[model samples]
Target: MRSFTTIFIALFCLGFVFGQTQGNDVLAMGRKVKKPKILSIEECKKIAQQEYNLHLGFHQKDTANYNLLKGAAITDWTIYLGIDDLPFAVEFLFAKHGLGVFTVVVCMRAERRYDILDGGSILMTEVLKRHPDAEAKLTISCLPQWFDTLRNKGYEVDERTPYRLYYFENLSSHFFVVFDLKKNGKREEVVIDLYNGFIQNIMPEWKTLEDLKRAQINFKPEPLPEMPKPKEKQEPKGKSSFPPEGKWEFSVTGVPGFLMSDLGKECAAVACTDVMIYWDNNGYLDDSDEQTYANDFCAYWGTNGRATYSQIYSGMPYVAEKHNDCYVPNGGGIRENASWAEAIQYFEALTQELGAQHPMVLNDYWPAPPHANCCIGLYGTGDDKSTWRYYRYDGINQLPQPLTVWRSSDQKWRPTAYVSGYCVGLPTVVWTSPLKGDENIDIGVQVQIHFSKKMNTSSVESQITITPEYARSYQWDPEQTTLMIIIQNPQQDLKFLTQYTIKIPATVEDITGKKLDGDKDGKWEGSPEDDYLFSFTTRGPKVSFTMVPSTHIESKTGCPPPNVQFTKFSRAILENKERRPFKVSFTAQESGEGSYELLVNELNLPEHATLCTLALKLTFTGNYHIDANANFSESIQGRDGIQITAPVDASVITQISCPNSPVPDNDWPDDNYSITNPSYPTPWFIDTESKVGILLNGFCAGMGHLLGRFKIPTVLVNTDLRILGTY
Candidate 1:
């Protein structure tokens, strides 16, 4: 009989190679190897086309030797699933008994560039939308253990939530779970294990629900029907070209004293074809202390040139007269004594009945003004040494002209030599020497003082004067005390005792305005006519600490130690040029002798950047003192009853990865890096009896490998085993 049916299939291939050398038992070696019984659906579509042709020949033979060049490369995900109008024999009997008999063959890549691999066809479209006759037996059988445990985890990890968690453990026994892989998604928890899956656990405690009615079905958010509602056209209204007395546009620019007090409060109506009255002081008037800026711009608006003709025919009309006549015989212009056609006929008789013009608008960043002397540069000046410098352009253009810069009285800036790309006003400059009683020989000049952009502020309690002048042989030095207080915006791992607030400054008040009280012995009580002088702030702005070493180490007991600290005057150690510091040492996860403060949180900066203060160096087997804000909530302390709180001294320790681990390589450090150390302040136990239980390692350097887990609650040798590593 065909050689007795080949001797009964050669004794079932010698009893499956004698049950795989039966040794390190996984159920006594898959129970004497028989398997292969996924009955119907065309034998699970011939084993999902032989596991997608062996995952397309190992992704085209390991994508031409991985990391070609450096970063970016992944781009080949063809997962088409099935369904739509069914009928290809009921979509091939529900994709071969629902996803080719619980799929299994998988493949993956990515050893760097932020390891990320995600789940496949979202659990075969949630098992064929919940099982249309078990969609040929659910994704040919659970999408090959969900893409072979996230392609054997190799970097780029995130099967989703808490790193992709979905328990389901057990719920009685009548389980007709058809489909639900995130319907109307927005998840945080969803555990259901129905027993056969070994009591699956998904309990990292966190609540706040409202919907997802236990995923039995009935989910919402689908709405997109009634297509026929788009008809609302109505707009036939008119009459309004916007000009019933609002368009007398007149713009000029030669230095109109920084544009007359914000353009006279933005042109408050003049009523005559609309209005727009602007001016310019290119005729000289840039306050440099001339009797305190002409007594504060003559107590407010009304001097420094132009104006006067009944104060401009009574305030409002329309006179745009940008100034610039070019004259510097000891500069100080009012037109250096009128001449540009008598200063344009005294500015058209002060805007004769409303309407004047002159250069109109040709500013080019501000030009015109260069006719005396010729070559004296400097540049930039808006304050501190009163801006305005450039002297050398007599007439034929070499750039720079309009001159008249001043503002002296020790604030300095009196350089008169105008003529090139103009705009300078400090006036006051003359030498005209005949040596007549020469005290450095000078004629009639000194009138260059200015300041009048509509001033206002003079009642300083009636300009006071209470002289006392009384001094004898006084000696009150408590050893000559020295004061110092300055601390603002310091950041770089700063969080020791945590408590910050500083405002003080009422100009250091005291003469009753309070603020200088430290008495008893901290000094300060106040006496030199005390005018507020408490200040206090120097011990702040400066923090630095370190610890980084986890580009994927996984085992070797627990490798991570670099130790670093810095505080009050701890020089510098540096490292966050894009963040890296992550070593927290362990100290049995802390408990008593108080001290763990590591809270470093820089992330997204640049609003005027400022974060510098990190000094952490804890290397003690006992006898510590470097908490500099690494504060581990008074160190753990939760034995026996097990309820320990407070332990988040952070420095980057967010573990919770599994499905095999390794996903995210470009050498880890993102999600904005740094923030996870002995960080277990709220129930992070899992180490049951410790066979090195809490391992979760995933630092990444083409390392992280298992990417598909979320169980937690460990025990190890006593037989708990839900270890599933990486973070």
Candidate 2:
């Protein structure tokens, strides 16, 4: 027993030493290897092909079938290659920074098929480890078992559905498995960690059938039958079909059956819901339910009773504002007294605009009970006084029924005798471009306004007013109901930094003569006469400057000492002149008369004139009138030394308005508002080219120091300005 124990210990020590040596050799090799460098596109393709073949033990010779795609993120590329005689393809992702192999994905082309490789990460790690310099740290998140697991979890995934397996790097590595749910056409994306098989998240990719087919790899769809061409024969001039013959009964899917509700008379609500649901199914709107939509819409329009054309027009904007994605143009109520011919025209227009046959909601389908229904189809024209057939939806209990109405000699339909009025829901614009209060508008910019209903061109043209107006032309898009005002000739290219107001009065009317009134105020002011006002400030010349109170000067001194000599002091003012300086001074007064003074140095005085200071008094603090000759007398040189004359006829004005107080900074009136921290710092200056004053405010702090700055664009420079104190 003792001899056996000794032999066991010896064997254990030998094994430990060998293990340590092997570890040390590994560390040495790692240290000797340099970091990998980025590989060229061709080199990466070659490496990927080699790795794939070496691991699979199959030589793929169809190099032409390889596709190289650059990733959306930088320094990432994928090489996709197909296997010979197999309905599968291999995708290799390479991180360009270190030429690292991120992942390898095998995708099958068969429907409902999963090309998951067991121990795919292990295989990748092994293959990458063959390179002495490579740092292989691969993880397989898309194993074949995941499909079975999802199926067990009640997810409908099949081989017929398209899927994608890709790798992404965001700080750390990750793998994604994306597959379509064949039952509902929704794409499911599952994210998993690269190092572990744990799922990080599962999200749905909202892609349409066409989008999926376009993005799917190796997806060759079956050809569709060609559409039959229309016959070349022209119909008789007076025998035209309103909806064309065959298209009268087109079906709209996903519309809910009409149901009576305590929520209110919901015919309009149901009809609107039908249109919304149909559009949603066709991928034009987000998913929504009819009850919730109707409830919300009724609440918005204040509809407690029977909905009318006025209410529909007013309420349509609210619907658009809430569900902008589902809002369509001309989708509001038609005119109350619209003629049958007019109604048919609008129906045809709506169908063409929506690119589908949409049902038209009629307020009074049955005259006896004042019932509402939808008109789905139309036939024949009023030109020949022929009978018109309307495919109507009465309720969910029955299919659409054909109602025939004879056209009288006056081009009127017989339905008018029983129905009081007609109303059809249409689309409208609840918003517009160049939103209100927009500033720095370009001089050459065209004005665009969107509307919910088709407008009467003549009415809209007459109601629009552009202040500081220019010669403009109008462009109307009947389909979009968008009015574009083009500046044929602007008034001096729109003055820079000047505000221009666009007024669209309530006089504007829609095609049905209903004035614009989106607010349902029982007033015309909401639409054509609603006094819709919007203004924008044109950008000033790039090179412009604004005068502001100088913070540095104001802080150090109070308005020029009451009686100090003007020549000896440095007056806070702006002087811009070639030879003679033009000085502007601001002064404040408590109760005494306002005054203006002019002083010139003896050396810079006019050659023949004597230099002397002149002062003029004003009665009030406001702007005073100045007459050069009346304000000052000619100069007298030393009581008769030479009788040098001064220029008294100069165009200098004696009226100098008392300067208002400097405007406070934006951060003023804080808890620490004090004289010690005067509202504005002195010496504020702004360049017009970069900065612009948007608003100026001021109060009297002392005499002659009006301080304020116009707000400017924040991007140009610092927002704060120092007002210079001047006297």
Candidate 3:
């Protein structure tokens, strides 16, 4: 909860030192002196109860919505906003079923924490706690002014709908964070990087488009808070809901334990930062600048308690790796909900194995009230593991001791571990193309590997080898977080329908010399101990005959005729109670009643330039004799062409149509809008990365059609995006 202003008191003393800031505001004496206008509890309560609504000037619908939960049973309270308690919350309240269909959770923290896009983290956490297994993955608004600004900034911006309208004021765009893969435990989603995996952004789904537009009228960003100072370790007072199955007396001196002063403080982030700071001081880091280097890595904890890997490591002055990256066993190998003893055993083994008595962070993943702490060192106050007084960061003391404070207003706390970001750990493979067990990969597809941390490029490159090898070219992103291996020399490409395995030796290390913890066992046995491996089988060389009608076009003389006979089908599916995967089945056919001439043309295999590509090679030879074929290739940027089908778990109205297929409904004045300008040309986008279906309607000839649909790869890859994974 410490302020940047307080942290920069040293800057005030230096007259000549130009303060470098990450904000648009200028510094006082070179450092930005932002004085937060935080109201007092009484002031905030008064405003929330009265003056706030006047400031917002809500219209009829909005005012009604705002007051729906205010006059009665609304749960209302105030807290410091952002990572710093800089601005006090006026009031955050949620009356069940007040806003929209998002009936379960409606919570708010700071102005910067609310999201106009996806529902925020608070909602996701609540949904996880309730549904446990539901995949919870935003907005109605307009922003012409904002779009113009973005356009001038060189973004290929054509539009920014459901955009934030205002900034600052009470209607300002709020702060938010996105978490992926699994950080909360097994019950929680997996925590992978942005390139691949499920993601959850702490967003609010209650506000209407109009309300959000009002808020984004002005723009203001959150400022950084200084690294919190650890206090003297104190035994926390209270009983935990979950009892310790086994007790262990332990003490680790010089453990930097910090107390959270703000309401939104994330315990695990605090504990992990403490460990990293301790590492810097204790020589565990190669480059130490007091706590500055550690602060650089842990700054996200103070802003909103969560950050993407690039958000945390990119552009930092110091190296992205450390002698030790606060390793977790198996990259969160321990189930988040594992018992205390299991977590202890894992960390204890990890610490002892590393041979450096580093502090460990613990989190319970308790959504209602998540708690975390950093354990300094292992010092048993009792004889052994069976008995020990636990001194935690929250100042709780736990043992066989029975202590209650009903007379006091102290809060109950849980000390546990989420395992993932609860501590920084060794690098692990976050995602890959032609995922393990994929039986239909393309022989010529480019393989991609996404790592959790920046890597020792040479260490990983030299040690990686593929079984049933093919001539391949290896390349990496600037950050070295992603690797792409292309099967080179079409003559030496892999065999069709053959399974292959990628082997990365355990000796591979991140930039700081930390070896890969492939098995996540938290050990460094070298060789096979931490080797990483995955296998995928390429698609067969032959085509199938199960295609269905997926295009709308009529042919005459082997060319498309003016009128239409092809039908378009679209449906909106929510919850997808059927548990269906993203798949569409369609077959291509060529038929007509006349002397037919069929022509075959050899098209190049999928290329990265087209993310969605149709692989069939047959075409109609004549003009209006009535030719018909199915091809749907779109997306020229070589990005994820098929992902355009639908967003993960989000409600979608999928419409299947062939490119250049006439837009249905007769909304136009004429069926042929280009009649007067018949030279106007229409084009069908070709998805070449994976595979797609394309139908060409021209005069008919003796022809045979293929039956099959494109198998869109979930990940978009390849620089040229030539061909994606095996289609």
Q: For residues 1-727, could you state the per-residue lDDT of candidate 2 as single tens digits?
A: 1133223322443343244443223222124322222233444445444333332221122222111112211222222211111112333443434533333333333331222221121112222333334421223213344566566656676433334333321111223334545334554544323222333223324133223223332332222112122111212235324555421323333333343332234455555544455554554333566566677657766663245543543454455335534243243222334665665554444344223554455443222223344545444333332324444444321233334343222233433211111122222335556778898788677888887666778888987888866567899884537888887654324444567898877667766565665443434545444556778877533221222111111211222344432211112122121112122222332233334343321223321221112222223333222332211212333223554433322222222222333434542332111233233433233333333332221222211123324332211121244321111
Each candidate structure's TM-score, on Cα atoms with residue i matched to residue i, is 0.15, 0.25, 0.28
**CA lDDT, candidate 1, residue 628:** 25
lDDT per residue (tens digit) for residues 435-502 in model 3 = 87888786568899987667899998898999876667789998787899976664324555567999
Q: What CA RMSD would candidate 2 show?
A: 32.1
lDDT of each: 0.22, 0.38, 0.36
lDDT at residue 230 of model 2 (Cα atoms): 17
Worst 10 residues of 2 by lDDT: 416-425
Clashes of 1: 130
Best by lDDT, which number? Answer: 2
- lDDT score at residue 48, model 3, on the 0-100 scale: 35
lDDT of 3: 0.36
| Residue 346 miss distance in model 1 (angstroms) | 23
What is the lDDT ranking, best to worst?
A: 2, 3, 1
Q: Which sections of candidate 2 miss by over 4 Å?
A: 1-254, 261-265, 284-286, 301-305, 324-355, 379-387, 396-398, 407-727
User: Candidate 1 — worst ten consecutive residues by lDDT sum?
Assistant: 81-90
